[model samples]
Target: MNIFILEDDYHQQGRMENLLYQLQEKHALSVKRLEVYSKTELLLQAVQEKGSHQLFFLDIEIKGDPLRGLEAANSIRQRDSQALIVFVTTHSEFMPLTFRYQISALDYIDKPLDKENFEARVEAAVLYAQKQNRKTVADTAFSFKSKYQQFQIPYEDIYFLETSQISHHVILYTQTERIELFTSMNEVLKQESRLHKCHRSYALNPKNVVRIDKMERIAHFPNGMTCLIARTKMKETLAKMGGEIE
Candidate 1:
């Protein structure tokens, strides 16, 4: 997991960093990297370069910035909506203030940060992010990380997977966004060639499909949700499905 921290208080930053490491060891986490940023621009640039960050820890205040940490957290979400964000603040007054950042934030932790609360929340977030990090192919194999128990998936169960225009993670279509696991579209495409990349953003698994209404540029799955098929790749998509390229 990669996490970027935007905190100005040197002493508090040190404490948070220590807790992060401790959490890693205690949870047996596979944290590949963690970054600390004093500037929002630096953090934003890093996130953009990293493609996606596993988690973001933003302090609700910056020493000199006019906007609060909540504002910065919101900005980060605009770049990657699925990125896990946790806002920490001494201002417990912002508890019901939750709605302001509810759309982007996964959780808000109050200061003086309690170890028990921190551990529980971070553990839950870490587990959820890990779940969001991977998915199984439709069928014929049982593959998954040992620590996780998501179960072997049958590819026929997959609806579709697509890359987001503004983010690094690809969205999975398992009929529900809840099944929307976050993995690189590249890895997914390479592993399962049956999934036709009908557009720059979408790759559809034909097995779970209902019908393609080409005139409307949409794919209707058995569950009733529709996905757009870009006109640019219409020929290739049809060819993959064994239909004549019109």
Candidate 2:
């Protein structure tokens, strides 16, 4: 996980930096990078560039700056959905405003900082950020795009994918919904190796397979749907499920 410190006070900056050093030694965490920025613009730019799997320590009151830390957090959330944002401020009055912004902030620290509280919050945030970082690495997602809309679907959510018979169109099946996307099955298979090509027109998730009827040459999912499986590909499908043919 990476760390970004955005405090305007020189003394607070020094204190936070020291606390971070203590955290590193205490946890023995190998943080990929650390950045300290007093300027809001620089921090925002950095967040847009490498905000994934990152943690932020933002001071609520920046002297002479109208765009305070809360605004910066709102901006960061636009670019990064999973970043851990912690607000540090002198006044406790602004604490209630966090619910209004809905930034999903991790925690808030009162200035003239308490070492124990600071350490505890930082430790919790770091653990959560690192857990999310590992999930990002392991659970790769398929990104969908169109003229105006775009979203990502995690590979594990897909029960199966098949051609729609329309040019550049495919039908995606999940337990919750079916989506029509303008894409090729080859393109999708190339993106994720976990999908098994059971037939010329279909790819299946072995983990999602509830049953396979050899006589019908079909694979079943828990959603009460079945996809044709080529007779020749049965062995490979079984192998994917860690089953040995008897």
Candidate 3:
């Protein structure tokens, strides 16, 4: 995993680097790269060019600059949605702003640092980064060509796939988007094992299913999207999901 730290203070930056080194030796973490930037603009530029899936340590206040770290993080998120951001700052008040920014931060570490607390949070962040990296490596995406562009749809991101109303096409429902492809349900099902035929027209991703309403024959997602489950397959589907009727 690549780790980036944005802190203007030299002493604080050194401390962070040392802590990272200590953690690496203690945990035997497989860190691929590490970069520390005193300038927010430089870090933002690098992230824009490199893309995310890296770990970041950002300071809320940079010398002579107001909220530069936060602004840089926002820009980073635009490029890398899965970037792990951990705020290392003296300003505890800025903690609430992470939710407002919707950056999906991993954790927050306060300044005037305690070694125990610093080590603990950073270790947690590294563990999270490793887990996310493993997921990306394991879950390969399904590649397809569209009229305008090619698409690579990851299996974990798919809630379900259905036979499109238009013949010879399939509709894939994800958490945030729906993609229509000129493909067959059998072709799509070959991409992943998590997907199963819940009905004649529908294939379900049990990982995305939060609840199964057996009586109503509906599989509910956390996003409030529901799909029909075949009555004959209800017991089988529930078994695959390891879930009971609600």
For TM-score, the strongest prediction is: 1
Q: Please give the lDDT score at residue 29 for candidate 1.
A: 74
Can you rank all candidates by TM-score, best first? 1, 2, 3
Q: How far out, in Å, is residue 4 in model 1?
A: 1.4
lDDT of 3 by residue, 1-246 (tens): 678999999998898898888878887887666789999888876652122347899998887676788888888776556677999888888878878888877888887667777778878888878777666546654444334323445556778888998987888888777777677888766645568899999998887899887778999998999999999999899888886857
Q: Tens digit of lDDT per residue, candidate 1, span 1-246? A: 677788988987887788788877887877766788887777877763221225887887787653477777777665444567887677667556547555457777775756788667766766766555442122243222223222234455667776765465666666434333345677667656778887777888766656777788787787887677899877776666677422
- Global lDDT of each candidate: 0.65, 0.76, 0.77
> How are the candidates ranked when ordered by lDDT, highest leading?
3, 2, 1
Better of 1 and 3 by lDDT: 3
Each candidate structure's TM-score, on Cα atoms with residue i matched to residue i, is 0.58, 0.57, 0.56
Model 3 stretches with alpha carbons more than 4 Å out: 48-52, 140-246
How many collisions per candidate?
4, 0, 0
Best model number under lDDT: 3
Cα lDDT tens digits for candidate 2, 222-246:
8799899898899888888788422
